[model samples]
Target chain A: MIKATNLTKQYDNGFVAVDSLNLQVNKGDIYGFLGPNGAGKTTTIRMLNGLIEPSDGSVTIEEKEVKSENALVSKLIGVLPESHGYYNWMTGREYLKLFAELYGVDKKRIKSRVEEVLEWVGMAGKADILIGQYSRGMRQRIGIAKTIVHEPSIIFLDEPTLGLDPQGQKDIQSIITRLNQEQNVTVFITSHLLKEISEICNRVAIVKQGKLLEEGYLDELIKGYRLVLRNENPTLEDIFFSLTTDEVGGSI
Target chain B: MSSLIKKEIREHVFSRKGVWIFFAISILFSGLTYSFISVKELSLLAQVEVNMTFMKALIGISILVSIILGSTMVSGEREQGTLESLLLTPLSKVKIILSKVVGILVFWLIISVISIPYFYALTYGTNMLLTILSYLYLIGLPLVISFSLLSLAFSTWISSSKNATLLSIVLFLVTAIPMFLSTTMKKSGFAHLVDLLSPVSASMLTLKDWLVNRLGFFFIFMDSLPVLCFLAISIICLFYASKKMDFLGGE
Candidate 1:
């Protein structure tokens, strides 16, 4: 479980990347955070995960402060940043093992845990190959594997399926769903893919220009939107466009 | 901590950069050794002089390599997008920085080992071998580490590896200027102060006392105080700079 209260990030150049916003992600829920480009989605995730400090307000994971140096927070959550970079020189197995050790996995269990994660991400067959040689889809899988190598209770994925093909997206979606449903792990994923979010996330939040526009259960939100639009069956795309668009049919 | 250090060594020492530097240093030492053995005018000099010359080259090359390693340690990870993951780990920032320092130290150790045969060959049939080894570890080790830490501080403050490396090298050259100055110029007000303050000059002066003048260890240690001070200052600066280190780098 994670809670952010009056969270805000103001840059030195007078740009407020995330306004004073509140969010709660319940345990074992696949929570999707939605926003267009420059909508503070990534910034919010970074704040919650303790990668960057929020200018004002605080984030607590399971009632522990999400400070940068908090070991408990580090153990509580895993994160796959939007622009996650790999060590091209390292093999997939080596990369995972390195993270496992860093995350304080039992020394004896490191090798087995790495192999298990590689298998979980469907990278077991290619474990020995250098990450640099992997295809983009393969790299994405390995990145996700790294995120969960320590088996953290909560995982934050920032645009995990951004550049993937349809099959690649499906593979990642299945992994996310399996982690939530089977393993009972909480997921806080940020993406602009409405269909992908709708397919996997039970709860969703939409934001624009650093402010949250809506947050609720997906079905309830959709039903509410359908009634407001006077349509019996409206796609999430329609609802998203209606909510995120200005009166002049321009993105706000 | 050990895992991070091992990763650094693998990424750097076993990489092409490490291999090429080792190969080039081997060739340079071979050439220098051959010149001392075969060259007409060079053969006339004392064996200790040739050995000291080798030691000087070794120290210079080691410092350069350490600078390169230190300057790239943080920025390279940041540029490659790997710093974020490392920072997200439970490892303290100080431990992360210290792990990088350990990596540079390992390289220095390897290069020092590589120079052994050359030092042995040059100091053959002389009583200077043990003394040379002692100074190499005592004087040279601290100097190399000082520069490495100083350069690492720069790397933390500058996001671009190129700029950090350039600034570190320039700073090193400025410190080494006293070593290149003429006796007359060194005695001048500004140069004299620099020569007294410069760690490189202090190191060279201590080496000269040990090898050429046969000065007592106490006297040599007194002359090497500046090098020790520089090492202390570099350590302080590095820890201070590391506090500002972040996923994006810079304060």
Candidate 2:
């Protein structure tokens, strides 16, 4: 479970990325956070995951307030930022082990967790290969594997499927879905692909210009759609586009 | 912090930038020191020669390799994009910076360990053994570590590895200029002022006084004041760097 109350993030240059926004996410939900470029989606995720401090307000994950400098909080959450990079000289397995150790996983379980995570992300075959030799898709998979190597309670993925082929995207989507459905792990995901988000996420929050526009259950929100689009089965895309067109959602 | 330290150590050992040069210097210095001492028949003269040659080798490698290791460690990681993932770990920024500094210092220490044979080959039966130990532990080790820390601080502040390398080399050269000015060029008019600017220059002059002029260990320790001050400054640089660095960018 996660709750953000009046969260605000202001840059030093007087730019407000996220302004006094409130959000709630239930446990075991695949929550998709959607926004256009410069919509403060990554900033919000950074705040929630404790990578950066909020200018004001607070984020509470399962009741504990998230602090940027809290190492214990980091153990419960795993994050793959939108602009992440990996150690090129390290093999995929070694990289995962480094993170697992840093996360304070049991020393004996490190190898097993690495193997399981590599298998989960479909990187078992190339686990020993240097990351410098990996293809972009392989690197993405390895990055995701590192994120879940410690089996954290929550994983935050920002553009997890970015730059991947259609098949790669499908593979990542399946992993997200499987983790939520089978493992009961809470996922906080952000993507520009409304279709993929709709396919996997049961709940979503849309933002534009750093302010929350809409948030609810996919089924409930669709049923409550005020836009009388001709398509009876309007996807999340229609809602997203119409909502983010102006400074705020005017017609949705 | 321990995990980060281990990772850093591995990176230094596996990296090619500084370690090879370190080995070459160690071997070359040892060979030269051994040969220089083997030809001297006079016991007292051989003793002085042993101390002088060993000190030169240790100090030479300390200057070059420390800068090389310090410059390469952080900037290389940042350029390779590993710092981003490193920051995402539970490791604190201070721990990361300290680990990087420690990793390079370990390289300097390894060089020292490898040079032990050279020191023994030259100082086998000499009274200079205590002086050698004292100088290495007090003077040589601190100088190497201070240079390493100085370069690491530069690496942390600068994003470009080339720039960091250039800056670190400049740091090394600053001390060398004073040495060259006072020794090679034999200019003393401003050499005193120049020596005041460099612990290395003061160190060289003090060593010349000790081995060549027969001054005792007290002078060696007393002359190390400048080196100790630089060590303190190196630590302050790390403190300032920890405050200024942004973990996400390593800027």
What tens-digit string does per-residue lDDT give for candidate 2 at B127-204? 666666666766788887888888888888888777877988887886767755525444566666666768787677
For each candidate in the order shown, give its overall lDDT on alpha carbons.
Answer: 0.92, 0.80
> Chain A TM-score for each candidate, in the given order?
0.97, 0.95
Candidate 2 global TM-score? 0.88
Give the distance in Å from residue A104's predicted Cα in candidate 1 to where it truly belongs: 0.9
Best by DockQ: 1
lDDT per residue, candidate 1, A102-192, as tens digits? 9999999998999888888899999999999999899999999999999899999999998999999999999999888888999999987
Off by over 4 Å in 1: none
Clashing pairs for model 2 are: none
Candidate 1 structure lDDT: 0.92
